[model samples]
Target: MKTKVQAGGVSQSPVIDIQDLSLVFKTADGPVNALHEISLTVQRGDFVSFIGPSGCGKTTLLRVIADLEQPTGGRIQVNGMSPHEARLARAYGYVFQAAALYPWRTIERNVALPLEIAGIGRDEQRRRVDQFLELVELQDFKKKFPWQLSGGMQQRASIARALCVRPELLLMDEPFGALDEIVRDHLNEQLLKLWLKTNKTIVFVTHSIPEAVFLSKRIVVMSPRPGRVIDIIDTNFPTQRTLDIRETPEFIEIAHRVREGLRSGHD
Candidate 1:
């Protein structure tokens, strides 16, 4: 059911509200608890990152929010609706770890795929594809196939495709985890600029603490197996941030705290 809670004597609602959410997988090895007692509230336009080791349920939680996976117990509301309902309404966009662009399709065609499926008009599809291509600085490469572009460019195309639907929430699962440090840094800067310009609520899942620290307003640290949130560390940095800010002591301190949180979770 939809939830609207009151706080500070005022009506405050969360864009994504998860309450005691638990998911168990019926594997051959028996029941595996992917997530247990997971609760989180993501306000509108908030940039939140979930960081944890492998098998820690970070990606699983993201998938749950996207309605790709169903929760075995408890409740989850996305944009004041059930996750399935919200997904059907196109309330959010998802970017996977891999670009997953079609090798046969041109970058522009790949970006236009969703619009085409949604029965958007030809002219409108062309307009949005062009607009988002430029948004991700890939307008010049639009005509090229995915195999023709560099890894970073391909990921940028994927991001542009995700934004084409104009969803309010962007759920990314380690989109740049495989890129080299230089390329990752560049994309991180571009992503921050894009986030600032669009003001969409983004929930990113990553294993890199530095990437989490640099991109998120709040970092959700998770434990290993049962994947519970051990800590939620808020950043003091301003929204208008550049890569140079990562070198500052403040940034390092936040990274250190995230590291400590992860360590404590392991303990």
Candidate 2:
């Protein structure tokens, strides 16, 4: 099946494309298949979510697209370039489940680490660091160490770090899974604003049905072990999504559909 790209309620060229993707791991016992013929496309500036049960290869597939893991077969292109090239060019930013911040570095310096590695000038790095911290609403905490903040605040700082370079694509893996409900909701809303402001393509992985439904322009539902694409649902909602939208009938309808898809996969 061909993957489709939906952006602004219409189809468009994919910013990230995967074709006949497959992955296998060789262990002491034998080879184990993790993913099978997984294919999908994410259009530029679109928020796409990957949802599935645990051990469904959701994270594995993400690693492949991020060039952190190699696929046993198939092809992947990010902005028309191979994943490796994209990684080398720093075209993508990744947010893992944990904040993974350095205990010693202040929040501002943490955000500036990427720029330092890229050899960016100190003045320009400071400018971008401040801009992103404000973007994530962590500007006031820039001088604090990671251990000084709460879990949610640390995650925000990590996000600011990721966005400091203004990457073309953002890849996130259950970024809010560890936070409380209230913090999670607040962060979700803030992320949507950042997405709109930056106009950057985003591919997010999550197991929360409501979270996926609320944030995604499209949701890619995957099946169990040896994961493969099972369904791709377009949200068709307006760009200015809000918490109120999640309570609307249209939003509920789409969420119901996603639930049905997940049930079908489990059965």
Candidate 3:
């Protein structure tokens, strides 16, 4: 899915491409615009974060990318195909804001649910479940149910389940938003490492400036209702960066720009 824009040669498509995208919801009272003229492109292996105030349509935009919500206007393509086609091709895995795990099933079984539905053999399912669980560092907890795990641990399990399908893209919607700061920081570190190892394109949704700065290669600052793209800020930090990088002036500078973009959009 990497962009192969060769010099004087044919160019490959970006991982995601959106052009003048818009969406409106039909409500009891009237039509409510959720997104307006949203245009952005994501390259393979890049990490992008969407951040905005509450009700700003960050999640709505993400859902559009996932094909969970259909757009009322404009166009979007995921991995050179329509979101519907890409989804059928298993081009991406989505981790929702909540863990959304079933307490009835053990961690391994939960992770295997998709594989099961795909009609994968038990042997291959076990292999993928084991592999992804180990990647998320949840191998030891494979036998535990969702209720038995801490919120962070359960979220990790949810991540493992998402990764088991070996998707080219990962869509995470505030996956750690509800966690304690200490735990969230730890997960951010781990997630960066995971991205480095897998080289998968990730589109994450978050409301935290620090979290977005820490994890994203590019941060898309969004406006209020009828969400518009206010600014797209790039973080040039190395992939191997630690949490300590947040203290650097470079990090703070970028965060300031993102904040200013938000404020200007409101104005």
Specify the highest-TM-score model's number. 3
The residue-by-residue lDDT of candidate 3 on 1-267, one tens digit each, is: 233323313234588999999999999989888899999999877899999997789999999999999999999999889999989888899999889999999999999998887788999999999999999999999999999999999999999999988898999999999999999999999999999888888999999999999999999999977789989998999878999999999999999998898888887
List residue ranges in candidate 3 displaced over 4 A: 1-11
Ranking by TM-score: 3, 1, 2
Clashing residue pairs found in predicted model 1: none
- The C-alpha stretches of model 2 lying farther than 4 A from their native spots are 1-13
lDDT of 2 by residue, 1-267 (tens): 113334234336578999999999898989878889988888787899999888778888889989999999998998788999989899899999999999999999999999999999999999999999998888899999999999999999988888887887899999999999999999999999888888888999999998999999999998776687889999887888888888899989988988898889887
- Cα-lDDT of candidate 3: 0.92
Q: Which residues of candidate 1, in runs, are more than 4 Å off? A: 1-12
What root-mean-square deviation over C-alphas does model 1 reach?
3.9
TM-score of each candidate structure, all chains considered together: 0.95, 0.93, 0.95
Q: Which scores greater on lDDT, model 2 or model 3? A: 3
Total residue pair clashes for candidate 3:
0
What's the TM for model 2? 0.93
Positional deviation of residue 78's Cα in model 2 after best superposition, in angstroms? 1.0
Question: What does candidate 1's lDDT look like per residue over 76-166, in tens digits?
Answer: 9998899999898888889999999998899999999888888999999999999999999999999999999999999999999999999
